[model samples]
Target: MNPMAAMKAYAAVQGGGMPTGGAAPAAAPGFGEMLQNVMGDMTKQTRAAETQMTGAIQGQSNMIDVVTSVSSAEASLETVIAVRDQVIQAYQEIMRMPI
Candidate 1:
């Protein structure tokens, strides 16, 4: 899996369409939009990994491709988990502040 291609796919998904040969959009995405986009990308990567694994099991896909897909999915899940942990920690700190 090419990193550039994966990034491009992410960008396209976040943009809500295929990337055009132009400058970035002017408006910033809302938190909900960003979360939705990230979830969508994660789902795509997970599905790709599953498909690759099934194909490999059937001798239709290369082991390297399956490994790459699985690794990508694992990395994405780790990133999500790290973000969640930070968010939870931040909330805890906020709750601990003198009110």
Candidate 2:
């Protein structure tokens, strides 16, 4: 399945869904700003994960909790980068197209 569809499914599975409506939901607040905010949040989460992992290795935290959080953060960051790359490529391709 496409990435967006997969994301929607994952969100639903994670209980992120709201009720369906007859009309489309309002555009999310901050539209373009939201992307930047998300990227920033992902970076913060990744850093936190790395810190947790380091602490775990140093006997400051439990290994299992560190492993799970780090893996999840890594996966989320990778997904964000992949989506950003796809969007940039699509924009570039569109710009090259003749009117």
Best by TM-score: 1
**Runs of candidate 1 exceeding 4 Å displacement:** 1-25
lDDT of each: 0.77, 0.69
**lDDT tens readout by residue for model 2, 1-99:** 224535644554454346477765544434366466557667776887888988987999888889877876777688678878988999999999999
The clash count of every prediction, one per candidate, is 0, 0
Candidate 2: how large is its RMSD? 6.0
In terms of lDDT, the best-performing candidate is 1
Q: Which 10-residue span in candidate 2 carries the lowest summed lDDT? A: 1-10
**Which TM-score value belongs to model 2?**
0.64
How well does model 1 score by local distance difference test?
Answer: 0.77
